[model samples]
Target: MLASLRQERILAAVRLHGAVRVADLVDELDVSDMTIRRDITELARAGLVRRVHGGAVGPDTGSRPAHEPGFEAKRSWATAEKQAIARLALTLVEPGQAIALSAGTTTHLLAHLVAADAALRPLTVVTNSLAAAEALHAAVTPAGLDVILTGGVRTPSDALVGPVADASLAQLRVDTAFLGVHGLDGDGLTTPNLLEAATDRALLAGAAHVVVLADHTKWGVVGLARIAPLDEVDTLVSDTQLTAEARRALDPLVGRVLLAPPDDPTPEPPLDPGAP
Candidate 1:
């Protein structure tokens, strides 16, 4: 079977069973134990599954995904890049700031990074995503922080939308916000769903500074709604895999663009907004 198909099956298996054994996957797919281990590792890397000793559990339902990705399919690619981006994003948050996080895999990673930090305490986190809210809730409440989740119609992407989320966002303001989206371009941010677009726009409007966390793949692909005009974003953070064309396209629009090197520790400075 093709890798995609096999991975999808593995996701399905995990979803159906809650978790799946490595040996079962090996026997079902006729792959070696090592191969199954590799597959499970990939899925775990994707944030789609939680691998235990001999099997993988389903992704945390409080977040995204309409259906479960099988254990083997959870880690499909870009694991390192996404994690790296997440780490960079964590650097943007400070202690005692009320921050909003958008709904997406990259932002989801950001949520985990924030949770993992021991020094930060009592964060006021607001989100319209169930997954993000869950992650932040788990991270903050134990540390005696407050987390507010917008209530609305829940979508397959794990976002809460409709009139409630919009109204709730308008009622509050935040210091900084981390936005996640389906795509980004010279024009603005885009998403496949119109409702999601509206929710993201609301979050942007409510924040003092908006930092977008999109991976390289999101640079050009078009989606249904535009969240903001290009110039509106305060900062754009992406992995080093971003192409020259994308960098050029982004440079003129955003205030500061932070390109995170996956390997280098000497971090690059934000690209000048005015420099050509």
Candidate 2:
């Protein structure tokens, strides 16, 4: 097939699926991997698609309104950073403690880490993420971990939101709440989904300590709805990739900021004094 035709087909597939893997595209197009990569590269150069690790995503046209990507799409981005943040967040969990995990890819990673750690067993986890609940449920030693899933309408990000989730969270209190957000700025942490924002607020209210788990990418990008201001957060956990300037700017907004270094599996020491 011609290069133009192949590129057109690839663009169509990416538009249809939101994301398309390289191997699948190769098989579907009956083209070599190199050929597909070249076509994708050209398409990306033309601003028709955004090239991701294993696939392409629809172009970010300024004309079109911004929206949150799906759970899988987000899970693939800043993976190392998310894992590092999760590892650090796990250190805060104690045996027999109850924690609430708000719906987000970072929190989902935290849930997986909690399920895998034998030391953190016998803990209760309340969450609005179906993904987090399922990960915990499928753990090898799920007996020790109690997972409470908030039943509600599922959003594109796989977050369970709405009145049902809010009501469920309101009745119970947890020691800490791990929140993942689409965007965090001077104003507050925000999400594109309004209902999910409401549910996240409920999770925040249910916990004594609110920890916001976000990557550097989330900074400066404001979402449609505000969840809570930075002052309300007990700790803000992000990767070391976060600039020093950004940290200085965020210092007064939140109680504490913990930077998780990517190279170090163990949690790094907090930048600020008296940080937890």
Candidate 3:
């Protein structure tokens, strides 16, 4: 195919899916890796697509570090991957344990799972997500689970963040915290909103263990505000789309990396943090 046609196809794929991996593009376009990389470079130079570590995302797909989209807009971006991560994260919860869910669509989904599971009864959940609090409140009955919502200013992503939220988090401790982040790269866990980042950090501080829930697309992207470093995370649950190279690089940064198959809900056994 002609270079123009190949580039057009690449742009179309990125726009349609919000992001496209270079390897997948090479296979779909029947071209060499170098050719796909060159095309992506050209498109990026033309401001047609934003290049990430191993792929490209649409120019307007919140690729910018400072770009912040409302929760509803982000909920539809990677529904399957988020669901897979949520399911894997659910396996980390134990009966009678207190947990915290930070504000994000992925964590919000996990909240729904926790609310429905009677086996996880007599549990306490603290969160800064209004959506998560609502899901837990409406889904569970007979007082098996306790839901606590922090008070603070709300962000576009439906997270309550500010000094109030931070203070509330500081007063309590949880067995685990499942954080949903905007990006997770060398700079660490991040979010576009600074206040939200501070609140997220408070969430991290109050948990005995921390699990970050992110999809493959968040691998290379960085956000405006830093939450916590990768070393602080006990485990990271992402979808199978996360490249093997990415996993190798990330393994040493965190305690362990768990890849949830997009179609498979079964989770890998939790690794003991003390295990070598």
Give each model a TM-score.
0.68, 0.73, 0.78
Candidate 1 structure quality by residue, lDDT tens digits, 18-109: 87776678889998755666677687789777554346666663123333232223223355666678778888898888999876666766
What lDDT is obtained when candidate 1 is compared to the true structure? 0.72
For candidate 2, which ten residues in a row score worst on lDDT? 267-276
Tens-digit lDDT track of model 3 for 62-147: 54434567777577666788888888899899989999999998898898788778899889999999888877876555568888
- After superposing candidate 2 on the true structure, give the runs of residues whose Cα lies further than 4 Å from its correct spot: 1-66, 140-143, 265-276
Ten contiguous residues with the weakest lDDT in model 1: 267-276
Over the stretch 1-276, how does candidate 2's per-residue lDDT look in tens digits? 999999889988877877677768878989876677678879988989865544666776211214557777677666778889988998889998999998788888788788778787789999889878877775535568788999999887888999999999999999999999987878888887889889999999989999999987667555667899888999999988776766977999898999987776554322212111
Regions of candidate 3 where Cα sits further than 4 Å from its true position: 1-67, 140-142, 265-276
Which candidate number maximizes TM-score?
Answer: 3
User: Against the true structure, whose lDDT is highest?
Assistant: 3
